[model samples]
Target: MHHATPLINTIVGGLVLAFLLGILANRFRISPLVGYLVAGVLVGPHTPGFVADTSLAPELAELGVILLMFGVGLHFSLKDLMAVKSIAIPGAIAQIAVATLLGITFSTVMHWTLVNGLVFGLCLSTASTVVLLRALEERQLIDSRRGQIAIGWLIVEDLVMVLTLVLLPAYGKLLGGESETMRQVWLDLALTLGKVAAFITLMIVVGRRVVPWVLAKSASTGSRELFTLSVLAMALGIAFGAVELFGVSFALGAFFAGVVLNESELSHRAAHDTLPLRDAFAVLFFVSVGMLFDPLIVIHEPLAVLATLAIILVGKSAAAFALVKLFGHSRRTALTISVSLAQIGEFAFILAGLGISLGMLSPQGQNLVLAGAILSIMVNPLMFALLERYLARHDPGDEETTDRQPGEETQLPLEVCHHALLVGYGRVGSLIGARLAEAGMPMVVIENTRARVDMLRNQGINVVLGNAAKPEILSLARLDCARWLLLTIPNGFEAGEIVALAREKRPDLSIIVRAHYDDEVAYITERGATQVVMGEREIATSMIALLQLDAAKLPY
Candidate 1:
């Protein structure tokens, strides 16, 4: 058989299985990632049919992670991380430390080898951004306060994961060599870290600036194929540079490269553009991880796998929930945020694979980690679905309430409302929607902009495509039952007329009307509005409310 034929067959088989399983996953309300991992396990070499040649799988897996980190780096600016530095840096370190210590403790009790136990801890320490991000995106909660904080916190974990990869190889190499001493191992470890530090400096000074320019230049050539090729080239180049030049794994280099590019202007473009390739390669990475799982090991060491998963998902979530709540979000917000961060992420695959290569993990230990990864990815979405339902009942407005950033009204409309009725879906309407959403109120948003309506719809928000000042629009919004009506349009005369008309019709409609300036307030008031809320006055009132609220009692 031609070498290319087996590779092609393997990829084709895996993809087909993945597609089928993904369909099932979606239909069943489960994450498609679960299906992808299962597909990998089914088609892997350890199984019978369509066994993928995994020798190249790990290398390809490296590209997948690189693309992922590249997207992360391009978007995750140090400034953003620094903005949340108080939480991200400390939260990431603390979580990893706690998880690792627990893993080590469990391993000691189970009598696993010290090296293998360390590998176990390393594998279990980090959360999977891919799993969590996908789940949040699926639910349209990606821009929420909790989601933003979770992403920032994940970056911190990525930093630690990268450092661990750089340090582990040297430690593991000692076990494979003849008559190695602990002192030499420590020295190699020091030198390995030093090399990584130097490599990071070189990348920052050189690769970060150069790579984006290379990508931009390629993009300017007006060739999609060329642009795709360029992304891979940069990712591979950095990965190769780290491994061949610095003795660090390609994943480590890829990560630092991403961190550097995170500071660039092209981060969002890079993320949006390279998604297909990242997803394609990312699929292969998970499949490769699934292939690493051994059923026999689970039969023999089921206790270990369960123990590890329990500590990682549940124990870790508890810690994160407490940490986030302490940081000032509501318990509901903290719960959702913590649940989102509960699973071990795709990057764990990278760390574990490197550990396997470096002899830090025994064959069984590797299998255990692989199984844990599969299970975690599988349950992440379900866990989120459960959590969402739980929060809806217990904390209905958590995501929307925590979400505050606004933009030109988008087509996606998943905005939650509270005691407010939004009239007009213009910039102000959408901005107010975002704010009211963060406050956890059920709001009925009325808008007439088709493009904006479409954008709000896409965002999974509650919206009516009509003028709220109209009687029919007000009726559609169920204004008779509404506690507050927010009017945000430029037609003061039209609004005044509508307000007069509404007062005549309903007589008890409590409406908050926005005016351009103070002089318009009297006319608005004369029209029978309960209150006139100028944008300026509203801001002041909100600030006062914020000031009055107990910061210590803030729900994250």
Candidate 2:
């Protein structure tokens, strides 16, 4: 029995195309988002191929946006933002204003209305969180002073976008209204602000207390599936309820739900559990944006497309550079900040989608936004690569600069010397770290998880906050004076990379790595790992020794 399943077909088609193109993009060293967007373009109504059900894509895309926002809220760290507030806050605002002005100017030249121009400008003003973070991570700069500033700047942009999402509809109505009085506009604006404030306050005071408790109880059941279900329910339920009761957007509701849940210790687990779903939905979100994009716009309106790209890549970059430099930061810092934010991504799509739904922005405007996004994302990695090469030639002392604050380094004490490098802080690494502590060995730990990093810091354990695969992160451990490089992380392929780097740095350094399988053991060993501890082999050996001891006791 065959079924005419529009939803199933849309999902299957989207995922299959996304995976194929995503792999291709990754192979070419481009962002996977580009591939997902391209996949949408191929399968869209505008293209000559199997078209996904257009009616179903947008609704799925909305779910994707909600999950993306929830993930953002889950990872939000106020402390990180506060560290770079001096530059990040003012810098982000000024850059947005500049980008918006450029967008509005282009719109004026194209004969669009001011309201449409405003919506278009706002969409162009923000950069992709995913792209910026991935770039920083690749270079091992996520914990550096420049990285912190970039992240804080992004947080400001996100908060601004959230507020923009809430006020845009009301603003649209106010602008479009012919019969509305000044008093009525004021009343409507005040009412909207009041409702937003009420939602935030309620989430902070009540939802924080209740949401975490519910999650904790779910987690206590020892059922991973149950905990995962609880998280989804909270995210989707709160989003739906916020629309019904507080009259806010789903994005805002999901964002608040995540923020409330973040207060829980199990928040990390919740985030880890929901990551696959969030990523799937996020991919759908990009695909939906691409589906709306008309490729012939580039052919028909080449000048408009170029202008939009200029606003994003050139205008926005120039504005950010000027702001960062004006704040008395180093030129390197300014360049990094500017180039890192030269592309627009998910938020742009979300804002444009909202504008379309409100009848504020034309389809032409949405098409332009999508075109700009695809082009900017495709070019951003090249920009980063050039920036790195340029910086390398101009400035050799990138890390030892005067701009780095004391806290920018890991919580390791300055006096600690000749410490071993311990990568990972999970179940296996934790046990290993405990043993190392008992042996009175001073060591530095490399970890990626926020929760684990916090716990390690609380215990006065020195830790670097990034993946060990990045050479810059490994360098932070002072490998020159280190006695041992312990790759306790579970992934053997990643461990192989670390081992290779360590061996190249210091041939005499003791290197140890963990493996789960025989193939992993062989791979790590081939990569110059001095020791490979296979868990299954060790378990069998221990069991045999215990059996021998039992047999000896019986004979005696």
Q: Which candidate number has the best lDDT?
A: 2
**Model 2, which residues run further than 4 Å from truth?**
1-4, 26-32, 61-76, 133-144, 178-220, 227-275, 353-359, 399-419, 447-473, 490-494, 514-526, 533-556
Q: What is the C-alpha lDDT of each candidate?
A: 0.70, 0.81
RMSD per model, one decimal: 16.0, 4.3
lDDT tens digits by residue: candidate 2, 196-239 = 78988898889989999999899889998999999999999998
Question: Would you estimate the TM-scores of all the predictions?
Answer: 0.65, 0.82
The best candidate in terms of TM-score: 2
Writing each residue's lDDT as its tens digit, candidate 1 over 307-382 gives 8778778888888877776766577767776787777755566776776777666666666677777777777777
Worst 10 contiguous positions by lDDT, candidate 1:
403-412
Any idea what lDDT model 1 has?
A: 0.70
